[model samples]
Target: MKKYISLFLLSSILVITSCDERFEELNTDPNRPGGSVFDPNLLLPTATFQHGDLITGYSGPILFQSMWIQALASTSTGGANYYSNADKYVASPSTPNYIEGNWNVGFSLSSRLNQMQILAQQRGLNNLNAVGQIMKVSALSVVADTYGDIPYSEALQAQQGISQPKYDSQADVYNKMLSDLEAALNSLSASGDQLRNDVMYRGDITKWRKFGYSLMLKLGLRLTKVNASGAQSWVQKAVAGGVFTSADDDALVPSDEANGYSNSSANALNVPDDIYEVRWSKLMIDYLKNTNDPRLRIVAEVPPAGLAANRNGLVVGNNDPAVQIGLPNGFDLRGGSFDISNHPNFPGATGSGGDVAIIGAYSRPTAIYRRRNAPVFLLTYAEVQLLLADAAVRGFVPGSAADFYRQGVLGAFTSMAKFGGETVSASAATAYINANPLNVSSANASLKMINEQIWATTSLFANFLEAWNNWKRTGFPELTPVNFPGNFSSGQIPRRQPYPAGESSTNGESLRAAVTRMGGDNWITRTWWDGGN
Candidate 1:
């Protein structure tokens, strides 16, 4: 729960900053290492060097999670964690609000990645290189996915002659990512350095390689729609070349919590939308309760002071004057939304609430955040296993579906153990297998079991990105879309994040080009990878 909340907060800060003038002020970095933004001398780069405007003795979880408000409910979180002043999920044409602001965060990180890539090559720091490139590609991939056909040709060239880059097609961006990943993996392998200062791996080269391969597979799998063959080819290549074998080797960035968690905003705001009532998306909560999954205690926390808990499972999105409960996504209670007058169930005392986590917050000794040294994982072997299980059923790849399924649960349990929590008893895993074993043919039955487990286990492992991805891909467990009486369109799960409002003013031509490429940027228009009816 800590890491999940931390990620949300991290993203909120990044997005809210969104290249604003005050952004530099937030970063009070004390270190001053010179020459080019991406100097090769600094092999193990810190946030201060890359971002310059940061504080020292303060760890940088800011670069940890890339925030993308993919849905309308996005504002609830932004309002709480980012702006710290917003009372409702309201945005006007003038400010464009937090959801739109996140687009800038993703791009800013990508720009840093580009800068790093150029400098590494120029200085022959090939040994210390690929990691930067890998991160850049990963960040840029999200940007392209969120806002199709972004300013690819001209982006990240402040040092170069171009400040405004032309938008590149999503297709081209994918092509570049694939090419860059391939090159990065090979480069890291060929150039051998001690790699002594890795926060993610504790200087483990093998783990980094696995991380790259896993990311490679994730990127490939996203194209499973129109490019099934291509997706398959990449998946196969990644598997054959080797990917993560266990969750411990997962890729993550550690938060610098030396200051009793005061230095990082993301670590501080770990609750749902920062307002607390994470109203168990009927889809999310029901699945665990139904399966008797024990991972539930780790995510939910009571609100700080006011709002009561929606205990009776007050069906979310239910906003009828006649109906008892449930409000639409982005429905402001201050407004006349009848369904959202106040939380009725488990609301916590003042400031006691928390957000959902990417991985388990209830690990053995203490939660990951309490460890004071836990890292933010980018990907893990457990996710790969779940994917493999999915593929096993689909016959897209060769493996025992049941075996892969079982391993995923066990591997996930093992990974969760490292986060200062109780080890998942083997009996529990066995019992789950007996009760909800993989049902090879009945896709929904097998998938529901797999995905629910994945969600439970990967709670602290992946952040909002994982949740959004699953919701977008399978629509399993079926989260109820927030029902707003005043919604601009039919109440449906939000599909893609809106382009940042700044794009309209700063990079209008490229932004419009992206919208044109992606069905005019409507909320309903699907991403290239999403293809469920």
Candidate 2:
């Protein structure tokens, strides 16, 4: 027994010694530099990806409504229209709290753009990387416009070791943006393996070149009222270099079942009754109804109540919910269209459909619909031709604006199918052309015709950002500030969105400096162009 106890005690002692060593090993000495996954490139793509998402939503459908609804062309079938607020006189966060959420989302995107630019420059020139630079400018523009002032000259240098960036003046930023876009346009000529990452163009340098040129045109046009000389020169350059000749060439972000960006924007706009609630505004409906445009049929369907057998002919204004068609633009009192139906009361799930709408809401608590494939439309042939026609009409270019206008119409018409939108065939194009011939051409028509066409295209196309940008540039179709109605007691349409609140609080000093130089950052604080005075 004594011998056995001795052996057992010794074995236990050895076992305890082993346990001590193992424990010491696991308690890792905090001495060595452990594996830190802090690669900039790793975070870069994620930022870039978010860039398209956040910017597209804020600028596209969200702000686009400000223009369309204010123009009285479209409305909130569900109060989803910005101009509906104008019509009803409601102060919205989209307006007042424009800069509230996700400034980081954009800065995150900007950071990525910054990194890509450096990577491309460091690695030498390639079309793919050059496109990255172009996207960088695009992303930054959204930041500047939204916030009034942005970190341009010194921004996005974290990869290069920039911690806190100073703000760049709005004017100077615009200038730099134009310069960057111009370079991006030139960079489109990069050959060979460089074109591989040109996802938008599929290794097509010519298309990238055109995309860059078109962006230049867009930038130039933005300065139309601010710097006619600058705007005119760039527009001429765009025409000379060639621009997006078709919608197929647009830099659209495609959506799908798994990833839909617009869904976020749409959710930020949900109305009561679980519906999207936006539809044709009075101005749009009037014009369409007056012209008897066929497209109206494709874009809008009568409300469920309006489509019911008993309410077959019920006009939109009728109160019988079952027979109510979508309200016209500026009509809100009677609930309008139903986006989709959801039966929340099925089983254990809480009662469905009493969703509280929150503006600038990022979580998009209500957006569960499958994400759709929507390519980001960088530019389009119709837009290029329109710029040419505008320049020609103004006598800024050599060619006849009339011819360009006709081409633009045809080109714009062809873009429909490429965007995953409704398309009319060559036959229809010919018929439309023959019926409305170049005996006048598309461009030389009355400003009303030319402008209306642009507006009509804007209304039908899914490229809401393009629509908003175009409106900002040309102010065509005279979508007089919806503030014109009681909504305009202050009498102004928001020219740009405010800086995201996070940036202001975290990066306050620089943001303040930007605001001071840019005129209090008020809705009335016009940027460079806006008719130049």
Candidate 3:
């Protein structure tokens, strides 16, 4: 009886101890995963997709940069007057919200990447950590470029009690980004732990390295105007470290429409105003037409004759190069003197009566761009080659400028197929390159040609923000600014977008200090790298 009681007491003590030890764990929800068990790889795709989507979405790039650069022109007729913020440099009701778009999106992406990197570090995942670093640079670079100074060195440190982080000057931002990018690129290794759920490269370390270097080269080029020596150093390092050599190396994130991760630019363009009122700018089309560029047919389409047909996204338009006409920028549909119909050499309306389409004859972006699942291009071999061409022309490197130019032009043509569009034939691309050779006469002439091609290629790729940035740097393709009434930039092309309105209340001191250094907070004030100082 004594032995039996002892055995029962010991068993009861064990049961109570076990229950006490696992009390919290047993009550915890299995569906809610803790950070310890979560995979960092999942953050890569989300950051990558959001980066592309936010930049290309309706708010900033679509409503502002795209038209500001005259790549796409809109009439802003009827209820689509928000487009005037882009088309005429006139503030719209949504301008306040739109100006903050990139700032907000960039920081959001940075925060996710920061968490991913911290987690990666804790696990000793070098490749994941390096990738996170590279992506962070890419995201924050856009922010610094858009706004003169932004939260950089101290950004995304909320857990460490850094809610109102100081804004780093654009120059400091660029310097740090270049250094960090270089370090991250060197850290990536093939023998490292296997990376999973990679949406861009499928864990290919080589391609990621190339992407990093390519991005570095772009950043280097951006500093050419303000810091030429620094630009040369970074460009040299990028080339030596190995940049993208082919379209296969392009960093394109795939969109899954069925899974609700559709392309945002395409979605924005499908809106009634965007589909009907928006058309390819005359400057863009005329350049292609005059050069007999093969992309004219692949990118621009004239809608079928009628208003209904033009508005119908399903109706395929005439893609014949000869018939495509581009709409002149800074024009409107309102019947006052500024009406597009009143412009010289206006293509006549396509239909009569209720079916009449005033802008039907003008070219719209082709169906390929409107596809919801089209891949978003982050960086491409074509852009890298074009930048190399410029570098070579400026004696920043030893390579032949002409050869790089040829590669760039051909790569640009070949890259079009990635849009899910009609592929430009290799023979045709070769023919175009052969016929139009790079003019290696004077350094200035070569520089102009190279940067102009950059503008054209970037514009076609729907990277209008980059296109604008390059234009600001090189002053190439010499665009004429619209002097519409109540313009924001005093009849000049805007150099930088104003900061988000919330910055005043949240980080007012930092914001005011940065603004003081920048001269003003409005659009015309240049960034540090843009010759502000």
Clash pairs detected, candidate 3: none
Per-candidate Cα RMSD to the true structure, in Å, reads 9.1, 13.8, 9.8
Model 2 bad stretches (over 4 Å) = 1-51, 58-60, 63-89, 92-105, 159-162, 190-192, 259-276, 306-331, 334-371, 419-421, 436-446, 483-489, 531-533
Best by lDDT: 3
Cα error, candidate 2, residue 160 (Å): 5.1
lDDT of 3 by residue, 1-533 (tens): 11111222333333322232232352355753334665666666667777787568764888788888888898774243888888889887778888988888888778778777866786788999999999999988988888878888888776577878888888999999999999999999999977776778878999999999999999998888788898999999999999998999988877777656777888987876678877899999998888789999999999989999888888899999998888888888778887888988788889899899886499999888788888777788999998999999877888899999999999999999989889899988988888888988899899898888888899898888888888888888888998887888898888889999999999999899889887899999988888933
Model 1, backbone clash pairs (residues 3+ apart or across chains), number: 50
Order the candidate numbers by TM-score, best to worst: 3, 1, 2
Model 3: C-alpha RMSD to truth?
9.8
List model 2 lDDT by residue over 434-484, tens digit each.
565433444335444655666666545544545555566666566655432
Give the per-residue lDDT of model 1 (tens digit) for 458-516: 44443445545655666554554444443322455445556766677877877777777
Q: What are the per-model numbers of colliding residue pairs?
A: 50, 33, 0
